[model samples]
Target: MANGLDFFSIGGADAHDGARAVHAWHVIRWLLCGWSLLVIPAFYGELTSTSQGALTIARSLYLCMFAGFALCLLWMLHTSRKPKAWLAHNRLDVTIMIGAAFSAGWGAPPWQTVEWVLRLLFVGLVAIRIVLSLKVFFAPNRLIGLLIAGAGVLAMAGAGFLWLEPRVHNYADGLWLAFESSATVGYGDIAPTTPASRVFAVFVVLLGYGMLSLVFASIAAAFIGKEERALRHEMHRDIKHLNAEIVQLRAELHALRESLTPSSDAITDAEALHSVPRDHH
Candidate 1:
């Protein structure tokens, strides 16, 4: 009688399906881009009435930023899913969002609908980026560092609010509020008074601290790790050099001893000549 062995196979065909999820996001992003293009003409009303050319530029930048970032985010998700991938996206995303938020706020007039839209977009992008990127900093020490950075952003934002008395008039004010919310502190003394402002505030509150924390922590950790690695490499190089020097010194010492000592043949010949003198006697 012969026995038979059974083999089993498991798992779905899309082994790295999460990676593919980013591509779907890319398709969604293009659709949004088409919509943004269509919407540009509509912004004429806000641009013409407010006379905020800077605001127009800022708004256009953010729209493009979002689309560009959405594609990059998809690619990032495809290749990696760690601090490296997440931070890479967050770095550009946060910088753009923060800059746009301030530029639009300061450059554009409030009565313009475009200004409000720009603000909302900036807030949304930053909040979303932060929320999504938080997973990269999981360690306790990193978490603490991130928390501090969040707090700093929030503090700056709060100070701006207090300075403006809750009025977000310009980039300075936008920056202040963005940082404050990211810090996780809302005094409510100078809170967002308008509906749009309030909504954006909520969005910032939700994503601010968490996202900033991870970004700060991941950046710090990377720098510290790089520094440590460099130091270790230098130390290793120095140690190797020292070892070679020690070997050379050892060889030199052996040569020195050979120079100091007479050859056995010379000693023996001397003894033979001296003994031959005695034999001659």
Candidate 2:
């Protein structure tokens, strides 16, 4: 069984080297993921009538960042010792990029309606991917980290909505409103009164619900996946122990059988003693 087992083993300089490589990859991935988060604010910022030069620059940066993300995913897939797992983790990012690229060429004012849709798609896809692929981001051990991240996103949404909504007095109020809306608390104190605010609220609601669903799903998946891996590891240990016991038992049985066998000289002497001389007694 030891000879047959072909899984990755932890030991030696090679294991250390592989661990370093994995750490480097994780850092690169986190950097790329963080960079993509800026695209949302940058895209929304461009909605204001800025200089054509600035708009072009923003668009270029946006595309470049996402392209870099996609390239990293591709590189991971290409160089991965576990290509299947890498593809499973990153296929969503690639799909989002491909979809956005196709949509970008559809009409004039590339960054207008279609752009908004693309941005929403990108946001949704990234959120889902983060929940699904990046267990480290939502690790159960760091419950406070998840809360902080969720609060940060909520605050950003609130700030953006505050700009679009006229009624919100301050960032704190806007954040409260965003939280209430996302939590479905909808207290009568603060509501979206303006048309823009209402529209933004619709988006906020949909986005919030989608994020909530993904977060729950991701948590469930993480637990189930962890249990499954643990079970598999335990089973492997049991199997190896059983195999070792079987080998030891077989060796003992072989020795016992040898002990029970008659010696060659004894067998020969017994045959000779049983042999009678032909009519010479």
Question: Each prediction's Cα lDDT score?
Answer: 0.53, 0.63
User: Clashes in candidate 2: how many?
Assistant: 0
lDDT (10s digit) by residue, model 1, range 38-118: 222323223333455645654665555455555654555565445353444335343543444354335444546776676
Among the numbered candidates, top TM-score falls to 2
Residue pairs with colliding backbones in model 2 are none
Could you tell me which 10 consecutive residues in candidate 1 have the lowest summed lDDT?
5-14
Number of the top-ranking candidate, with lDDT as the measure = 2
Taking all chains together, each candidate's TM-score versus the true structure is: 0.33, 0.52
Local lDDT at 46 for model 1: 31
**Candidate 2 lDDT trough over 10 residues, lowest sum:** 5-14
lDDT of 2 by residue, 1-281 (tens): 33322211211112233564465566566666665565555444445424776566556656666677677666655555665655544455666566445433332243567656765666566555444445556655454566667777798878976786667878888898898777778887888875446646766786677556556766777688899999999999999999999999999999999999999999999999889677665
Reference-based TM-score, model 2: 0.52
Clashing residue pair totals per candidate (backbone < 3 A): 11, 0
